[model samples]
Structures are given as C-alpha cells and as structure tokens.
Target: MKRQFAVIGLGRFGGSVCCALIEQGMEVLAIDQDEARVNKYRDLVTHAVVADATDEQALKHLGIRNFEHVIIAIGDNIQASILTTLILDELGVEHITVKAQNDYHEKVLTKIGAERIVHPERDMGVRLAHHLLSKNVLDYLELSDKHSIIEIIASTKMSGKTLMKLDVRAKFGCNVMAIKRGREIIVSPQATQLIKEEDILIVIGADEDIKRFEHEMFDE
Candidate 1:
C-alpha cells in the first residue's frame, strides 16, 4: 500500500516537504489557506485543498486523523500553529511534526504533543557557523543543545597516529565514530586503525569537548 502524508501550510518548508513526499511516491494531501499556493501544488500532489487548519471541523472534513503522518508548517503565526497542533493531538493523529519558529514555539508544540519539532533555519545557521569557524570542520549535526556529531578532515598532525595512540576519549572525551577515506567508510574503526591525511573523521561529543579536541589535535 502507498504511504499517506498530509502537509499543512504551503510555504517554502511545507511546499518542499510536499514535493519531496510526492517524489517518493507517497500520497500527499497539500493544505493551505492561500488558494494560489494550493493551486501551485495541485498537480504535483495527490490532493490539494485550501482550508483553515485552525478549524477542527475543516480538519475532520479532510480526514486528517487517517493520515499516518502530518506536518504543520504554518508560517509566521505562532498562535495558529499552536492551535492547529493542539487540535491534531486531540483528534488522535498518530504522528505530527511541526516547524518551530523559536524556542518558545517549540515548547508550546511539545506541550501540545507534537511528535517531532524542527528548526530548519536555526539549524542551517548553526551548521553554516561551524563551517566558517574551521577549515578542517567539514560538517556538523546538532544532536542536542550541548552535544553534536561533526566531520573533521584529518590534519598533518593526525596523519600517522593510530586511534590507540591518539587516546581521544581519554584525552578529549570525544569518540571517533567512523572514518571516511575516499569512497569507503569504516564504522567503529578499530583502535589500531591508522589515521591518514585528508580522511574524514566522524566525531561525537559535547560541544565544549569537541572544541577542545579540535584545538589540541589540529591547531598550531
């Protein structure tokens, strides 16, 4: 059977999610308050409707509870977003993901029982800032407010050292989860594995510990 999804609010984030789900061959019901926005995705998705999601009756009319997953991507109006999420929770929707505007918005959504909350803009900004901070830092993913997983390009100082020799966990309290060399990736690399220049090291630890590891291993 085909997977079913409903995306409410056809803004950049919602529109992108709708298109991506449709591309994956999932049936997507695209909802928006703007007629023009709904019309734009009408042909691209399984269904498109202009409806006020804040109204419980309209949501029931759309059979929203039947969908396995629903995304609330309302733009700008935090009040509307919170109200819509609360109604969906009360309606017994199994999974609800809401795009949060800020920390306070996320807190409200959590209380409303949204299964997942995303801060796309804020996350992207944090990732970009990490990229700017160090040339060796290839990418970063925030696991929580204080911890993250980061990809760092191995430097000359680290090129010939084995994992056992580096003693990263003992020295810096960070774990090297994997090593990416060329097209190959080594998961849970053995302590004897040799580090090579340009290898991508996937490390996970608290933000402060990661900073310390980077400074001690890579900085001059």
Candidate 2:
C-alpha cells in the first residue's frame, strides 16, 4: 500500500524530503508559507499549497489528519515548528517527524510528542569529522550513544590476513559484516577470505571497540 505524507515547510530540508517521498511512490502534500517554494514543487508532489502550518484550521482544511505521517521541517523557526507539532498531535496524526536545530529543540519536540527528531547538520558534521580524523574511516553512522556501524578501508596491516587470522571479534570486539570492492559487495565475509588493501569493510560494534579497531588495524 502507498503511504501518504504531509511535509510542512518547503525549505531545503522539507523540499528534499518531499522529493524523496515522491520518488519512492508515496503521495505527498507539500505545504509552505513561501509562494515561490510551493510553486517550485507544485508539479513535483501530489499536492502543493502555500499556507501557515502553525494554523490548525489551515491544516484541517487540507485534510492533514488523513496523512499517515507528517514531517515538520520548518527551519530556524522554533515557535512555528513547535506550534505545528502541537496541532498535529491534537489532530491525532499517527506519526510526526520533526527536524530540530539543536538539543534544546529536540527535547521540546520530544516533550510535545514528536515521534522522531532529526538533526541533519549535526549528523553530517559527525560523519565528516570522523572521516577526516581517521585515514581509513570512510563513513560512520551512530546507532546509539555507545554503538555504531562504520565503513573502513582495509589497510596494509590487514592485507593478506583472513578474518580468523585477525580475530577481529575476539581482539577488537567488532564484527566485519561485509566487504565492498568497487561495485561488488560481500555479505558475511568468510573467515578465510583474505583482507586486501582498498577493500571497504562494513563493521558493526560498540563505539569504543570500533574506535579501538580503527586505531589498531590501520596505520595513520
């Protein structure tokens, strides 16, 4: 079944979400106060309208309650975002996701019953910082405060060594879940599969262990 979504605020973040949902074959109602932004996405989404999202009457008139999910992507307007979320919750929208500017904003949204909160800028900063700090670290995704999944480039120390030989699970407490080379990806890489330079290893483990493995397995 196709899911229905309503995205309020047609800034870059909200616009991107609207486009992505449309690409995934979902019905999207794009709303914004900016006439230019709404006009830009008029043909891109199932419906595009210029309105004040903070107004409960405007939201109800647009049948926002019928949507399976509502995304509040209002940028730089905490009052607007908070008011929109509150109105959505009052209208009994099933799921609400909000983009928060900071920790304080996130907490406020959570308290108001937002189902999920995202800090895109903070997340991107973390990913970039991790990659810059570690030569072999290609990507880093935070699963929780204590756990993460990372992609690391296989280095000389790991070249010619098999999973069993390295004993990553025992030594570093990290699991090498997959190996990627060029366009090919190997899931559950065999214990005997020799690691080669330039192979990207997808690893999952506790945060501390992942850091330890990166520092110990790769030469800086």
lDDT of 1 by residue, 54-135 (tens): 9999999999999999999999999999999999999999999999999999998999889999998999999999899889
For all predicted structures, in order, the TM-scores are 0.93, 0.94
Give the C-alpha miss distance for residue 25 in model 1, angstroms.
3.9
Give the runs in model 2 whose Cα sits over 4 Å from its true position.
Answer: none
Highest-lDDT candidate:
1
- Candidate 2 lDDT over 1-220, as tens digits, reads 8899999989889999999999999999999999999999999999999999988999999999999999999999999999999999999999999999999999999999899999888999999999999878889999887999999999999998999999999999999999998899999998998888899999999999987898888855
Backbone clash tally (model 1): 0
- Give the C-alpha lDDT of model 1: 0.96
**In order, what is each prediction's RMSD in angstroms?**
1.6, 1.4
For candidate 2, report its TM-score.
Answer: 0.94
Which ten contiguous residues of candidate 1 have the minimum total lDDT? Answer: 211-220
